[model samples]
Target: MKKIALLVLVLFCGTSNAQKKKKSTTNPIVAVIITKTENLTAEVIKPNFYIFRNENSIKKDTLLLKAFSSSITPTDCVIKKFVTKSTPLYYVSWTEKMNSETKLKKETIVVTNVQIWNPATKMQVFSNTQTSTNIKEQVFLDKNKTASETQERNRNEGYNFTLLPTGDFTLKNKAVESKYNLNTVTMKYELPQKSADVSKSSKKKKK
Candidate 1:
């Protein structure tokens, strides 16, 4: 009797641990790389987005997500203008699988720093927030009246900011509230390098 009780207790503990592990979630981080910066305006050469645990998620709808940049990019684009639509410069996502037929589900979300870095100026802009929200999704198939699923999930997402044309942006959310601010201010004291001309001067001689 004593042996049977101990085994049951062990099994219970193991099951609880497994359940907790299954419920764990991971958040994605955001970033951008600006390859060009002329005057105050700039261009993003590449954007780097890092997502955690998105590979294992399942999706029933692509239009269910709402994500955007709290502020526009420092410069304007010819094809698409900023601030009109939810910007795609930042991304946060996670994946889930409901069944074998369900490949992978992705949610467009945000949970942390939204950053833009200009390597040319060595200037970086970032959001100051650690934000998260709970997501509940219920799907009902029109064709199959009885087919449906309800899912409750935690989504990580992020902050608001002010983009400065001078290669800087101000975060609307404070570090204390979001715990995403720096104790030490970011230094940008370096003066822009002056160009040197090796070619012959266009100016004619005084003679």
Candidate 2:
């Protein structure tokens, strides 16, 4: 009788551990892509943006798993195998460029892209891109033309985009979350600065 009790207790403990592990592993993970730029003045804002999106300064990396929680389970049983259910995974990405290039070519504007994925379903839930523009006002520049007026007149704008995946997915009986944490690989690089225009280049050559 004692041996039977011991076996039952061990089974119960194993089940509990398995459930805990499953819950912890089911949280979604995020991935990110970042980009940055330098010396983005009003005269060269477009060029800077082009450079940011271009090969050099663009960076891509997986997001660090911050905080996540698994779905609620309200039942307890010994030796009851709980098949893993599909869960949405969130991916966050961002980029930073000179927000107010003309205002402060030295500053940066940050942009982010987020996506939701579910391996169990083999589908994406949602995807979105967000941009944070850090507009810095220069009192010196404001003296010539009011900062507010310049900001209003300037056509430079900030925006965000989002999308939801369409289609259906099926879950399998073998679906199980791995306890081993996953990691994101990051790629960091710098954008290439544009060279002087023909007129400027010719002047340097003449000098």
**Per-candidate alpha-carbon RMSD to the true structure:** 21.1, 22.8
Q: Local distance difference test, per candidate?
A: 0.35, 0.33
**TM-score per candidate:** 0.24, 0.24
- Model 1 ranges with Cα > 4 A deviation: 1-39, 46-106, 111-121, 125-148, 152-154, 157-207
- 1-207 per-residue lDDT for model 1 (tens digits): 999999999999999999888777543343342221221222222231221112224321121121434442322111111221222222122221221123223343334433433222334433244455555566776677577776768754444544443333444443422112221234322212231121123233332
Runs with alpha carbons beyond 4 Å of true place in candidate 2: 1-85, 88-100, 103-107, 120-122, 139-207
State the RMSD for candidate 2.
22.8
Write model 2 residue lDDT over 90-136, tens digit each, in one string. 33233333333553333444445443333334344444344455444
